[model samples]
Target: MRDEYYGRLLVQRYQLLEIAGKGSMGQVYQAKDTLLGGVIVAVNFLSRSKMNQRVRDRFMREATISALLGEKSIHIVKVRDYGVDEEEMPFYVMEYLKGDSLKEAMQNQPMPLPKFFSFMRQICLGLQCAHDGIEIDGNVTQVVHRDIKPSNIIIIKDATLGELVKVLDFGIALLKSDESPTGFMGTPAYCSPEQMDGKALDNRADIYSLGIMMFQMLTAELPLKPKTSSFDGWFQSHHYQKPKLFSEVRAKLDLPQALMDIVNRCMAKTAEQRPNSVTEVLKVLEQIEQNSAPLTTQSQSYTANTPPTVEAICLQSIWPKDKPRAEIVFPQLIQYRETEIATMWIMLSRSDIEKYRNNKPHSQFLFVGSPHPMLLWLTTLYQDEQQHRMLPCYLDLKKPIGEKILQILNQTGSYRLILFALEGDERCVCTIEGKVPTRKMQLLKEWLLESQNTGANHGQIKESKRSLKEELDTLKPKLVASLQRQISKKH
Candidate 1:
């Protein structure tokens, strides 16, 4: 049946253009809707030879679910028509999307933070609409998209939203009132614990899958890594294993603590522990976006006897005269690999700080420092709300601070502030009010250079390696408890 229908007209309305894609279930064709001004559309046809009763039923169900969902949500692919051809094989038409699948987009690297968030928010919106229940014959029936993985999510270019998200494939979606077969149905990597157990499910199952998608988008990796290739092993891991913390997996990425917390909740082992609804997830995402600051780059130069600028003003509020004040300047521009750090620093500067001796507080400061993992970790932990009350400054720790910088630091009053410093083999967190000694500055530069050399080669390797056996062992107790609960329910 391969390419048998090419260049043929279906119902004298749709002209098969070319083979768009092929899956285990059916072959999709890029077609032109002759009746509708020749608009491009996708037509999926079930193979006549392979079309058994069960296959036909599933194909129709997919069409029905997609049609119902498309009417309610823009994020869903719109179904334009459904019918059978002259051979009596069933087919459905959908709006053709000119974009790549999420799986394709993430094949090479993880998406940028802003783009990732935008895509996620749209996905949640579509899921929420589906979970809200579709109306049929005056009754509302809940729809659970059992299969929500990257491959099923399409990213299209939109005039307004730039990158628009469209969720695809509802072949296995379950209607709450429908008495369908309760079998394990979903991609193993994205399946929720309950879904893996073949237990009753709801929209929360989809949320779990979405969580896995988020994890992958952020790190270009899955949270759960099954030791064996067997389906049973993967199922058990999803059911019993605890997902690795995002912070631990991508420590240098500088993700917001709040966003990570939301993802964590979404992937909770128990459905009850996850957000009650997709709407709730959307709300959290909105809050994070609203509070997040934009990342920007600025280049400035300072000379001796220059008047105190905003950076100097903010430094006065952060450093106290009674304590040793120090500024570390790196000779080269230290690249902050994580976009979250730049946003965090921006938010920190906007926060309010008590003025010293009637002097105005500064909101911006040059960051000069070595790229230490500890510093990155600490910065990531700084929440959005805390940004309003603290003055944060950025400095390059690799370069020597000139006399003008020392004058500005010494001018500030005594205050408790955080100075991320590295001493010999240890990373130290200290609060100082007086000027830093020249000798100490020299030592920090040497440490920064040495750390950079070693980190360039070993940083990623160290972070990526984990003991799979230990991870599986920790999940043993949880697996036992879950099995016991299932047994008790049967009794």
Candidate 2:
């Protein structure tokens, strides 16, 4: 088996060095891309004997989808090239990633809370991007990674983000809009109740699998144990048995009740009981992080009656003054500062800052990235119990506005909403930020697709702008209500 592909060249480009691994999809080889100065890469080929159309279609789709997703999110493994061999076998070259599989890292031990939070968030971000769906033909089809388990996640070292996690193997990912028949596909130990029943699956099914991974990550044990390792045994376990409580696993397991609740909700027998989207789950995660913030020296100094000054709130002491103030960038925590918490920094004149503090400000976040790569990041920070301060910055990918948003985000870590603000002026009285759980980016993507499909001859650009205006009109009230709710909640 090893000798078969030992020194073989694929597509007259990739020189196979050795067999790396093998799966149901095909064999993966550690190879060198001859066209790229002999750079190391992983080349995966379809099973040689069985060149059936079904397997070929699935393999090609996996490669295409993985490549498309990798372009959008850093967490998904990137596919570089695809080709067919002389024997009509399909193969794809991917970036060779060297890391320990999450399963290997688990090693029957619970992951530390901090690491678990960081890694799980990265995993969810990847899943969320997939579930957000990709444009296929004229439709946006949600990709359900039917197989989500510890083994499919790779953790590698990074200079900025530390342990960078990448989700691997999209061979069995299901496009919900695809009418093709797919058999029961998932690791039995981590399959959702719906998946085991051969029912049509959705993001919830992946969420279910994610729950099992979460349980294992926290406790190093499966929540529901099958009587045997067989399919039927696991089916019975997933369908009939309840997930074991944290206390049931270990008497003194130090874990947050909130974290436990999230895991349990994900593993719920019915998908309806689970969190509807990853954003919902992320909201809870934000709460957890905020709750876990240790009281810092600065925090101890400030009282509820006396708020921190604009200088302190803006992190002026350690702010990146070299970077342009109007430019949008990734949100960076004040890690070196005494107060280690998530905050947005902005520079404003003393008078403007004072005026902003006096009045309640609104905020809004707008993103249009399909037809154009642009993001209108905005925010309003509660200055006190009675008022708010507005911050806004627009980012265009084509210009300097977008430079650091994605690059810095990738270097640092997972998906985080970077809040930005403009220098106060007479016209800066109003601002807005998204508060609704709705997927704004998804809607924009679909509208962009529709506009593009309209073609230039049909006034495509104008049509898109009009439709977008209509959508914004409808969305504004919901967003305003969301902002008001935030204000009320604080009061």
Candidate 3:
């Protein structure tokens, strides 16, 4: 028998070409956008037979969440448009991607260390974007992807960024603000202990799942195998059994200790024991990639090579005296190949430094209101003179976390801000010293209000960063002049 909807057109725009795939909630079809001159797209429709209020809500939420997150990060799959068809069945179109699923690729063999680093970093970036939360009903609510596995991640070949990863299927993702649903939901092998028990969850639960996936990616076997492929079996295994060590799984697998440590921490039985945030994971991965050598089997150990570590540019001598407990931000000149370039640097205080200890950092974006739309997000650990890793987060200004950060800044009373000209012959062409006086604390409060009131246009974040660059460009000359005056007084 022929498929009924194979040749049908949806919304009079999408011409369904073929059935690409099917899932519990709906079927995905390879469709062409007739309105866009036959551009290929993926259209997912909610099964009409299962069209109840609960299922419909989940389907629509998935589309909305995907659309919002895709706008914020390229690692997420993009949803182009969504609506109902003539049959009143809800459907959404997504950018059709040509790639292999991570699950399929894994079947061939584990990825090389460099490829694994790139792929895992991209996946974490997507996960972090979701965890950062999105604005819904005037509040920022984090998203927990209840189902995170290899099959959901698509790896595409990119000419520029090498391999680009796109995380798919938010059908079962739980919004932090949503009420807990009953029963187990997720692949048993990758489910966290809390997930297996159907308990209240957070970002750490996802970290648990990621740990299992990481292990499988390397060893090609699960760390904890249940006696049976049933709910109770996985439940017992997740709650009672301990994960096998990397060496136990593959004795000859020559891997970095740091990498093994990360996997172990991620797969911790309890959520509290796992890394708090994906940014924390990214920071560790960054360090490992820069410092560790590629893994090789015993037979191939002769070809193993260790990558050179990035040299730390210490500024302890020039650090401000008054703001001993405050963070210092500077623009440093770095020698990259043949040219000297400017990159951001950060020196953190003991308190600010603690945030990154367990992969929990107080990183959040502070936006500036109209006249110019700009936002500032602090980077806690600065690893180099070049190549800064930007982990963006839009923290609610009214929340305790946001308040705590601001209070710390106020209590510290001041912070050091250094300026540099990357094109200059000298590294520190001039050092301008300044502080946010106690009298200006009120001014800081006003600025915070402005940022809270600023409309967060997700698509324009990069543009806002450009606006900030222009503002910095305007402020640099004045700081340079101030430095000149201080030098004259010394003479």
Candidate 4:
């Protein structure tokens, strides 16, 4: 059967070129659509005689769903034609994509932040279209792509969008009225808790899968570690255990706090806790992109005012001497783009510095800082309760008085070591590294206070805090510029 289809044209129209891929359900062939100006298309054929009634039904449904969903979204792979051959085997033709699957790309390394966000937004849009329902026979029927994972996501180059995201493989998709007696399907690692439990699923399940994918793209690792390769192992992990926090796992990686929160919510154990629909997820992502645009721009043009030094920010004497029990935590490098001057520096607001002094655990801060305008804009966007927390720290390029603040940062694991200098009125906010900056800093300060109370001189501890406070106070107003510009002359 393979040989017969490989050489001969199906229905005397599609000229079979070569086998593109083969799967458990069917085979896909690279074919020339003679009837369509000889355009290259992918023809997926399901050998009817070789399959049971169930498999055949699933295959036909796949073709129909692909066709329906494709019409609703450009992100979904487009289906052009569907028919049965003279031999009674079913085949469907789709627009041939000339790119690798997301699975293949991740094998090299995780995608950069800009590319990852862009691809994810498109994926959500495609899924939202499906979730919104498709019109058929004057009735709308909702569809859920039960299988959403890296392998099912294809990256194609488009003339306009650049990197286009195409979601494939709707073979296991569930229709609103579908009553198929299918058991559990979908990759275990990426499956939601509801999906694993064989409970009725919805758009939220797909949201869970997306969260898992986002975690992988950001850190190249899964949130939940499976104990065994069996389905039960994964099921137990997804249902019973709490996945490690993204910040906890990738402590050194600088990521936006809001973005991580969204990802975490998407993977919630219960569907009720997850985003109500793909639309909600899309809205949140869009807001993040809009709010982060200014800071992203600043990071791209980040430059330090001093000489570029290869030396890691020194942490040895930065901490207070009396704070013997306090441990220093230094920021780890996420990505470095070299320029004449450093392009990024960590910035902290007055409130943020105060939080560190107070040392509250479980307080997660974004590595990227929010520009003043962005902060003001975000406040108006979210509720009053959420306004303050949504603001991010930006990089301050002004020179530090000495190594004292550097020591405090190292001990608290609060800031990255990017040097920055304010040349003019340009105000910049940047991301800092650390899981619990406030707690760490508080511990260090506590240790310092204790030492002074015992035998150490109280004058030094008070002077250090006073000096740091003065420096921060002096820099606060200057960092409020709405516009950030690169200095014309290099320092």
Candidate 5:
């Protein structure tokens, strides 16, 4: 896709320098955010044509994942903003670094042992970020970077230091414990066997890729080179073949025993046999780093011993002979707006009644909303009501707004009634049906009329719910008409 301009009327940050790189869904450009006053930034833009549901989900999800990773030691590209231009093209702003691929770094000059180990340590830090980001909804979703080849590993050149590693390509990575994941996603060469088979995968898949990368970084050669050109054939080799030892690439590059031993554990065929986690990998790497001693030619024997901790629980999925699932299978819930809200209210009603039956009356709920009187009303109601509870929802969900409201209600069913105050024309009352209590409805109608000083309060009986209202004075007859039709239809 061709390059574009600002998202809104206001001039944005980062002046466009030129296109730096492009992934399947977006183009990464070297830009200067003019508003930020010429600080360099990487601008990733996804053309509208490329934005199918999956691509859009992946694009936005990048920002969500990045926000969780604010570590200075981690090699993650920081996300500045994700938005659309007037033409509706999706773009994300990111921190830019001048660097070549690790493949280039490896090829350019033999890295000093200290620098080499440092790069490896940095990679683990970035992976750890993905494996443990607190989500937009206040839930932690473990990120697994399934692709970890040299190409995706950028070596940022600094004026002072030689290079710093920044691990990229989190867009296609899986978030753990998600329900009903769509399908397998990642580069084939670097993909874990489970990832290749469309089986469920978790953090271990990333460890496997890290293993392959470590192998390349140390030995300077891939464990397996498929004779056939097809990617499927190349992937099949991972399942069938024993990886060539780092010794095979020793001619090209020599790594110390401590580092070599750690790389061996990462290249294990089975995910369980691999380093149990990025954390474990870091431990081994530290061992390599702290050891100022040396290893001889015979000391190069690398054993497969990954320590077991809570991380072993994640690796347990690999024990069975069969390949595992490629991603999570979350609980399925229906996807309607008002119907979802009603379902939530129904659950809340049941829970509150249960609470009343059991005799516990006091509770507090922190209602969150952007500052508005309506939000203030909801929070005040939360505090004022006793023996029954009502609170506005704060959690961010993957679903739409109305659907999320229902989810919160369903999840926290003890609410006597969750209050929602509408702003502008996005009305929910007309859409809700027989599930609404008439008492609440009447109270709400009067409340609306008093707030606006009009509508059904005039008392006429002729109608149906409307999407738009030119005047509140016009609603009473419509309300009466709607109720009569409902009663007559029921009879």
Candidate 6:
């Protein structure tokens, strides 16, 4: 990403290519997927020398989390994939935001309070998405945009205007949570008290930041005195001691008291004492607007409390099924994660432990292949993470190889054994010592083919579930209205 900051291609894979951009987190690269053809993406990478081990890990982990977020088809930037460059520099791909950040717009195209509030409201909606959102994990991964300043927010001039108001820097910005060693949350001026101090912060911190942004957008000056806090030798103070009110900032503007209160309370001293929730703040803003003259484009289409589509298959769907699995002793595959390897090793270990646990013994898998890169990694990972028996079988599933597998399973009477052949077909027919799993093997082959041709079965199921949920969401209100009408007639 260094040399090819904007236009040039720094790294090239089969389909992926990288180009860079100027951003808060240094240069960003636009990666193109040549295989997909015309599908271009932006890749955010932590530059080379500056990235230490933890930063690199977090950078990679952030992409994993983003991918797992699985909020597909939403307007926010989409994270695609995470991998290392030839130089071993970590990078991940995301949907490129076409327009410049809000900072650019603030300078280039200023808007009136009504229009600006509408845009910022869309951001607040995005923030609320983080607040009450469900993810691919099926659990709540509450996303607090730790850095919600103008530069990170973008109003895209797009084919779809409704999708215009988007919160950029969806990942890796406000990542400075109590979970990490680095407590300093985000940019000094915009960061809230709890965020600055590394407290167990949540959505309220973003609300505080939103208040600060609103103040700046209207007043053209930060609510708190210009900081240079990093220059002020470390910690900066929250405007706890009677900071001037929004009305005070521009007396003529005299933002409605209700609006002023919302802002003041958002920038409250204690997060607990802040507005009950972001939804509450939105209501308060609406009330303020109602009492005062109408703002330019008051949106009633999507409000903050608008219910969300909570899918069941996401990460939070079921706790990991990692309760001790069957243990069978088998050679491991490399390039696999610990969990993936554990599944194979544990099954093998279980086979060894429960050799006669049941009359109908479980299957033994004959793993035959000219080790593909993925297979190799999975083998290595199984050894490293699973810490199973050191011996791992690495053989091609050729004619004689098929005979060898037949010999082992037949000798052990482990005909129930499962076979995982890379070729998985006539490349190595079931010329075993005894009977072969023609039907079961065919089924297995079909499944493996499905996974390769389509994708993870779980991912496909998730997509279907997501689609069903969207349809249900569209009907929920109408159904409620119909029920109400019926009840009225009965009454």
Each model's Cα RMSD: 24.7, 12.7, 12.9, 22.2, 20.2, 21.9
Q: What TM-scores do the predictions have?
A: 0.59, 0.65, 0.62, 0.59, 0.56, 0.54
Taking the tens digit of each residue's C-alpha lDDT, what string does model 6 give over 1-491?
A: 33424443435642434544654443476666554444566777776666798777666656665554434213355576777767777777776667767676666332356656556556655666566654534545566667778887776653213326666665454432337435665777787777777666678888888878877776666678734556232245563444456666676775566666777788787787788667677656644444443212212232334421111001011111322222322321111111011112223333332332222222323221211101110111111122222212222221122233333333333222222222222111111111334554553354333323332222133344444445545654554454345545756
lDDT (C-alpha) at residue 7 in model 5: 31
What clash count does candidate 3 reach? 0
For 161-271, candidate 5 gives per-residue lDDT tens digits of: 235578876677667766755566777777778788877777888888888877776656777777674777867787787778666656556566767777767767778
TM-score of candidate 4 relative to the true fold: 0.59
Off by over 4 Å in 6: 1-26, 68-75, 108-111, 133-138, 170-181, 226-234, 239-241, 290-491
Reference-based lDDT, each prediction = 0.61, 0.68, 0.66, 0.60, 0.53, 0.48
Give the lDDT of residue 121 in candidate 4: 77
Clashes of each: 31, 11, 0, 20, 25, 41
Q: What TM value does model 6 have?
A: 0.54
lDDT ranking, high to low: 2, 3, 1, 4, 5, 6
Residue ranges of candidate 2 with Cα displaced over 4 Å: 298-491
Compare candidates 2 and 5 on TM-score and give the better one: 2
What lDDT tens digits, residue by residue, belong to model 2 across residues 344-447?
34555545455554444444546454444444545555544344444554444332114334233323322222223355321222212223223544443453
Predicted model with the maximum lDDT? 2
lDDT of 4 by residue, 83-138 (tens): 88887888888888889888887774556776786788778878988888887778
Clashing pairs in 3: none
